[model samples]
Target chain A: MKKNYSNEDLHSEQGATISGQQQKAIVCNGLTKQFGSFRAVDNISFDVNEGEIFGFLGANGAGKTTAMRILCGLSYPTSGEATVAGFDVYKQQERIKKNIGYMSQKFSLYDNLTLLENIEFYGGVYGVSRSEIKIRSSDLISTLGLQKEAHKLVSELPLGWKQKLAFSVAIFHRPKIVFLDEPTGGVDPVTRRQFWDMIYEAAANGITVFVTTHYMDEAEYCNRISVMVDGRVEALDTPANLKKQYKTNSMNDVFYELARGAKRADN
Target chain B: MNSVEVINIVKTYGEVKAVKNVSFEVAKGELFGLIGPDGAGKTSLFRVLTTLLLADSGTATVEGFDVVKDYREIRNRVGYMPGRFSLYQDLTVEENLSFFATVFGTTIRENYDLIKDIYEQIAPFNSRRAGKLSGGMKQKLALCCALIHKPDVLFLDEPTTGVDVVSRREFWEMLNKLKKQGITIVVSTPYMDEASLCDRIALIQDGTVMSINSPDRIVKNFPKTLFAAKANNIYKLLQDLRRNSEMESCYAFGEYIHFTVKADDADIVRISQIAERENHDGLEVKQVIPGIEDCFIRLTLDSGQKIMDRKK
Candidate 1:
């Protein structure tokens, strides 16, 4: 069920084909995004390997959202090159959008829509066949233990349940990559763990998971992490290596050490 | 006397019970935390205590004023930073602070010392619009506005939810300083790590109070001998350990898996041996001190299971 898009045959003409067969899911080279005079995202770059859960960490106003939007092809980068799921962020945004799933910091599902209706709507948007949608929707609902509340409007669900449903729908299209922006903000620790479980499941199924979160504990779960400080990647490494480098036991300490040294107060 | 007391308060919205028979007391000038997941009634209880929402039953008092009867006095004497950002978006940072100060019949300069540390960080950007400020700056501004009145108590509902680690730490540091000035502080957050920063915390779940204690005491009271187990193929290790009859409960904890032994006498040696027998490579097992989060999960699960068993 895990489809690997590493093969050259799947490469479209919109982006440069990755030469090596290392199968990187996302590649960025000096990616930069600027809003007016402020370089919200300075020259920054990183690669996300297939099936790897990449954790993007930063303080508020640290340009994480800007870089993520650029990577997701929602916004254009000022300079540098990046490819997502083998599609150019600049030239093949349509193809990239079709292949990527995104869950934002805020709830994305329609509040008035029932749980089932929201799932069906997203399925339709992704062009999932009706028969496939039925099977997948049932599977998702069951997996999230939402069978009893399937007909309930999203507005009526608890915050944790809504988050779980939003995540389920994000990956409903079976995209090769999924982007979660602070998916667990204000969520309880138990529900946060459950959300990470979903992320692990998605990554295990070959979907590259890219997530940005303020919770240091959640950042530790990622296979590799990038800490953006003042619009630049202060460090990018395994949580273990980062901890060792900073001589800290927790990701919270590591993030504080890097982010506190930031010279700019506003970004 | 308790600075804040919640006596079996219950709040309901139609069929959903947002806060159910919740009772607690916070000593004056103590930094108290109401910790829980979202929809766990932390906000509902805060609303009741802050005099924003009236409880359907029971009663709560803040600084000797009944929440229902002295709503006006409570409103005047308490500073509240709602979980969501609620500052005037169009007003400049300076303007927002001045406006809040004026509404309270005071001036920012009059109470400047109270929020000096927090306000100074965003002071350079005072001219920036509240909506235009970064999340950290906006929070600092919000805190400044909340403190400009120099109230006797502060009600901060999930103030650090979206704040970055550095800013979050700074915000708590500011809170500690404020506490030293003899102001009672009640803050709510979803982050269990932040629970450790509080003097005492009330863990809430499903609209019920699960436990209330200091963070260290809560961790000290964790009933299980928890082990931090890690190995290559960590997910597979989780599955293998779950099959082990000696393992009581296992849950993923970051890079390592946290599991408790079913038998009280089982030690790390036995756990490592099991991992070894299962052919798990690079097996590392260590007895680790459980944090506030571990305590929270255990307590919440125990309560949930108890309810289920009673239903059965």
Candidate 2:
């Protein structure tokens, strides 16, 4: 019964019409990316509803980064169709970039810049007006309670504080969608929770959240998750439904079940 | 005799005390873990014991040799894989592994059996440049290089920080194999779940050791009975739970909120009543055993309170 329900959920959105209501923030149909003879992203299809928190999970070298890059407009797909924030991945890459925020653990805010300065720089880069950037940045600094340290260089702050600031800066322009790639990689447990609360807040405010993480517990927090193995999405469903289908107690088991059979080694 | 010993080691950089009088010991052939988040001074402690950096005070010994006085001897007896990828990016996988082997006055053939299980996985890409390999492949090669010398002790810093679940599980399995060979391994990781895999762990935070014991013992030592609660809206439930005066602390843990109450004997029924009063839908609450993360969080909070009290 659970298997049938999951299959229905997966197929219900595929090739579904986008009406005035029930808008989708992202839509991909048979998306494929090939490099020479290697297909990094096999024919994959999924849709993320507006204001939904979607988790994109995969093993190392499973083509998750490639798929994300195509969706974020950083790279073009070899074939198949994908649209982000109602903009085409191929033709409207610039439009997609303008409406999305991207943050990765390896790269986020500028280290040399002060907290306030980093906010202003990212705000300006997103095309927010100078006057608005001024007011919002101050409000942001106070909201984060970094008032005394607002002028201090970002490099001086602890890892937790830097991550929070980087996240706040990513969404400063109020982009429609935010992409976080392993945002809480090495963050402390408490700080990691605080970061998730920020994600929850962003989702509450009608902004779509698309994230990738290695923590299986975090996978349970997503409204729906798609697990990729060997460039193919092996499972896509709500955490509860996936668990029932796989007869497991957690997302970790579900992932191991699907990925264990993968012929492609992590390379 | 202990394979590694750190006696009140203190390391500072200018105004920051990166490692504050931290001390721990690892038994010979034991899989010990230094578990903490970033900037928790795991690296500083590892560096001091590995003889790469000198502690401002205190002493450390690896393989029965003083870290400071017998630095060269300690260096030769231990293998260290830093947090960052320190291998030569321009060098091929084979080149990097062979170079490390030669540096330690050994060759790949000399200790081929020690690294055979790990190196064989990446041997297919032996000619590929280190930079060209994928993240998982790079880590595998790094492990192979670290083991090629067949050192008596191994120090791995955050080896699985960004690795996926499948790869991480595989890595742990490999570690277990190495342990059977009688090589003392000390690994550091931000992932709390990995703590249980170690024979013993030292939970460090803010440059101090919070606790050191087997994972089961640490979890068993949780001072409060924990509860896991769920509702239709987890975030709303979290906010509502925090507002309740009866609750001492509440944090989101995956699908549910794991919390503790101020009063003793706070069972599932009492927590359910609190959630229902908040007008939550589909409320479910139950008592659950604490994990390493829960213990870590509780310890960190307690230490933080201690610091606040000291200031007062």
Candidate No. with top DockQ: 1
On TM-score, the leading prediction is: 1
Docking class of 1: acceptable
The weakest ten consecutive residues by lDDT in model 2 chain A span A1-10
The residue-by-residue lDDT of candidate 2 on A1-267, one tens digit each, is 012223423332342333213588898999999999999999999999988999999887789989999999999999999888777899878777877899999899899999988998898787777887888888888887789998999999988888888888988877778999999989988888888888998999988999999999999889999999989998899999999999989888888888877766454
For the predicted complex of model 2, DockQ is 0.38
Clashes of each: 0, 0
| Tens-place lDDT digits, model 2, residues B220-278 | 99999999988888888888888888887788898889999898887778767777898
Per-residue alpha-carbon lDDT of model 1 for B169-210, expressed as tens digits?
988888888999999999999888889889999999989988
Give the Cα error of residue A88 in candidate 2, in Å.
Answer: 1.6
Which ranges in model 2 have alpha carbons more than 4 Å from their true place? Answer: A1-21, A265-267, B305-312
TM-score of chain B of each: 0.96, 0.96
**In model 1, which regions exceed 4 Å deviation?**
A2-20, A264-267, B305-312
